[model samples]
Target: MTLTEKLTTEFRQRCEGIATEKRSLLNIRAFEPLPADLLATQLGATILTPKQIPNLNPCVVAVLLDSDQWSAGIINQNPLWIVNNPRHTPARRESNLMHEFGHMLLKHKIVRFDPDTGFPLRRQSDEDEATYLGGCLQIPRRGLLWAVQCQMTQTEIAVHFNASQEMVQFRSNVTGVNI
Candidate 1:
């Protein structure tokens, strides 16, 4: 779905507020990069790989280790254990982690798996909200504006934010801030 269709103006503003609040809690300026690792640390969230999941089935571990299709997911809520795909690149990993963090921040319910198919039964609206909030957390509107003001290129902004070039472009498009 298009960004506008998924996120309302008020919802977008709320996401911006959340991002700003998170940054403030970390003592990070709006223009500064908020690394996913740092945020996870602050949130007391533990990041793990498939191998770290104790007593996992060998077949499941093999599948997780070999696949690049999955990004990340929240495996535990109380202690906040997130399992990220080690196969993805660093930039993609950051984005994946941010997306997981978005779900946590928004208090999205854990996706339940279908007993018949073993596929996750997800709520599209929740996924959309998490996606939008993830983008906001990765590249806040104010941060995009600051980067633009500094005459940063798309690659520069991506590198600065530890985001993919596509994410930087998406932020620019959603925020109506040309880079």
Candidate 2:
């Protein structure tokens, strides 16, 4: 199988596990938004905007970043604190938070900061996996198929699932669904 196909399978399995463990339906048919905040709460992780973090640098905060930039990261390992970029749209925020949750679920190690850049560095594999899982959490393949079967447009599916249009398009590409 292709790397994306493998990742897709793994993501689906993880979604099923999360659903079963959390006593929530996968809800692939309804194109429902996955309760990422609820999942974070259940996992004992606190989600916060950059401004909410104590003594954070104002210049580097979420409000200053571009939408296409990195949106969130796990700042603490023990207490599990996540910092999400608030400047992003609500749908992007959800995807960002879900990406951090994906890291937590995958047990990715705390990122090592680059001394020169002062930015955390992560393995490409880990990043790819988390991104894939986050996208899956936002829009499962079954959900995409259901949306297609329902004659939903990309915008309609994005709205229904609380996902960005880019996310909808990405899902369509990955799942080979025309939407």
Q: What is candidate 2's TM-score against the reference?
A: 0.80
Work out the TM-score per prediction.
0.97, 0.80
For residue 91, give model 1's deviation from the true position in Å: 0.5
Tens digits of lDDT, candidate 1, 58-140: 89999999997788999899999999999999999988999899999999998888999977888888888888889989999
Best by lDDT: 1
* Pairs clashing within candidate 2: none
lDDT (Cα, tens digit) per residue for candidate 2, span 1-179: 44366566666567545544443433333356676786687789998877788787777664445445668889898899998877788988888987887788778887888999877788987887777767777787777888888899889999987888998998788767778
* Model 1 local distance difference test score: 0.92
Q: After superposing candidate 2, which stretches have Cα over 4 Å from the reference?
A: 1-30, 57-68
Q: Which ten contiguous residues of candidate 1 have the minimum total lDDT? A: 1-10
Residue 158 in candidate 2 has what lDDT? 91
